[model samples]
Target: MHEMTIVAGVLEIAHRQAAGAGATRINRVVLEVGRLAGVEADALRFCFDVARSGLSAIAELEIRDVPGRGLCPACGASRDVDELAALCEACGNVLDISGGRELRVLSLNVD
Candidate 1:
């Protein structure tokens, strides 16, 4: 799965950051994953468990779920959305996605 690639990148960043800060181990990693990012959190966690070694072998992962948001141009309103091509509930027009496409590391606890 692509989640393995994502996990590999995350771990690489974690290792680099920890080493840059003169830390030998990573204690925790916090990630903010948006609903519209199209990546499964469970798969990421599983991949992390399988791929992590060395400095991050015992690191804990914390994933924060972010809800998708959209703006309706026809209605001039913003609302929560579940998918990318969601229709506006108020005016039946297509919504322009405003948020919830993020997949990034928010923080890392290292020492």
Candidate 2:
């Protein structure tokens, strides 16, 4: 699955960062995943558990969920959205997405 690829990349980065900092191990990794990012958290967690090795073998994965938000341009109303093509409840018009398209590693705890 694509989550394997994503976990590989994340572990690569984590390993590089840990080595660069002369750390013996990676304690934890914090990822920010948005509702509209199209990533499955459970899949990612499973992939991470399978893919991690060496410095990150016992690293804990923490995922932060970000909520999708949108604003109705026509009615100046804001609301929570689940998809990119969400319709505004007030004016029945397409909403301009404001947030929740993020997929990035926020931080890493290393020793």
In terms of lDDT, the best-performing candidate is: 1
For each candidate, what is the lDDT?
A: 0.93, 0.93
Which TM-score value belongs to model 1?
0.95
- Assess the local accuracy of residue 91 in candidate 2 as a C-alpha lDDT between 0 and 100: 83
Which numbered prediction scores highest in TM-score against the true structure? 1
TM-score of each: 0.95, 0.93
The CA lDDT at 108 in model 2 is: 96
lDDT of 2 by residue, 1-111 (tens): 888888898898889999999999999999999999888999999999998899999999999999999999999999889999999898899999998988888999999
In candidate 2, where is summed lDDT lowest over 10 consecutive residues? 1-10
Candidate 2 accuracy as lDDT:
0.93
lDDT of 1 by residue, 1-111 (tens): 999999999999999999999998999999999999999999999999998899998999999999999999898889889999999888999999988999999999998
Cα lDDT, model 1, residue 97: 91
After superposition of all CA atoms, the RMSD between model 1 and the true structure is 0.9
After superposing all C-alphas onto the true structure, candidate 2 shows an RMSD in angstroms of 1.1
